[model samples]
Target: MFAGAQVSLYPMADGFVGVILESLSALDPYRDQLRIETDDISTLIVGPPEVLFPALRDLYCAASASGHHLVLRTTLSRGCPGEPDDPICDTSCLANPSEPLAQRQANALETLRLAPDMGQVADAQFSLYVMGNGDHMAEIMGCIDFLKQSGTFYKSKHFCTRLTGDAGAVFATLQQAFCQFGPANGHVTIDLTVSANSPSKR
Candidate 1:
């Protein structure tokens, strides 16, 4: 029932400090809904899936608005056995594991369709980890199928999948993958890197 993410933002510009500090304001509206702590390394956001992903999207969008190359590295997790459950992390957005995989995929795709466009483009890659036993590969493969049809899927990589499109849809796809592909109450995590306005593209 607990969900959270460790996020670090990198702005590939001379005024990186200013960009990072200013973009943090994007999380202001979410402060009441999430537990956020920032230090030298990364910012930790603890909250429900509903709020967590949007907060990340807003933060990235705010920074990318500077027209500088920006990268966000995030590790998102839920139902970690090692972490104590907190009421603030409670959410009803998770898929029921007992539900059929096809139904879950359909639900995920529908959700992506409704995702709002954040007016920014993003290129991202991530690996979803479904911890604990019980047909993990089936769940992962099912998630892969969902990604391909997500409209943001770019391709498959060695150990992860690549996604590109509007920031909103991309992040929504990630949220669905995190929530729907694993056991309803099992530990699940994602390692993700998102980029915008990269000079390498030019």
Candidate 2:
């Protein structure tokens, strides 16, 4: 069996990278097949179902402890008859490849039975801390403004942006925001949370 997943790492990029590399190395022994690809904003993993689950779980733990919030989406491969699909394939199969990690997570979460009566809305809370850059606060605000102008966030606050919409909308927004931070100088840290709640409950 094969599985693929995408995860969003919160906090400093270096911290997130460190956590993932560490977890993957620790889980390597159990992985019958493993392949990882990462860019600035996210990471993708493809491997045997058994190995991927543990790796995913461990990655989550490490990121959480390091104060890096994450959003994960997984798919179980049902290989075609007489032909086993590639153990690791392209990332296009991921649901809403265009959406941001946060939105994707919120959308997936809304499918759960968290509360029977509450309406489901995509929610996000995140903070960014930039080190080594003087006037860090201003730069961060500039980044925030770029995100807002780009319409990546539904409603943006000082540092915590709240998105209320379907999962796709939320995810797209967050991913866009992550990309926006690329040009800024200094070390960047992000703390993110994506969730859903019934309208009745919120």
Candidate 2 per-residue lDDT, tens place, 102-185, comes to 454444344322212222234556665555635666546655665454333567677576554444344444443433332222
Candidate 2 clashing pairs, residues 3+ apart or interchain: 11-190, 100-171, 100-172, 103-170, 103-171, 118-198, 118-199, 119-198, 119-199
Q: How close is candidate 2 to the true structure, as a TM-score?
A: 0.37
Estimated TM-score per prediction? Answer: 0.99, 0.37
RMSD in angstroms between candidate 2 and the native structure over all alpha carbons: 14.4
Clashes of each: 0, 9
Local lDDT at 108 for model 1: 96
Residue by residue across 43-160, what tens digits does model 1's lDDT show? 9999999999999999999999999998999999999999999999888899987899999999999998789988999999999999998989999999999999999999999999
Q: What is the lDDT of candidate 2?
A: 0.45
Which lDDT value does model 2 have at 179? 31
Q: Which 10-residue span in candidate 1 carries the lowest summed lDDT? A: 89-98
Model 1, runs deviating above 4 Å: none
* Residue 66 lDDT, candidate 2, scale 0-100: 45
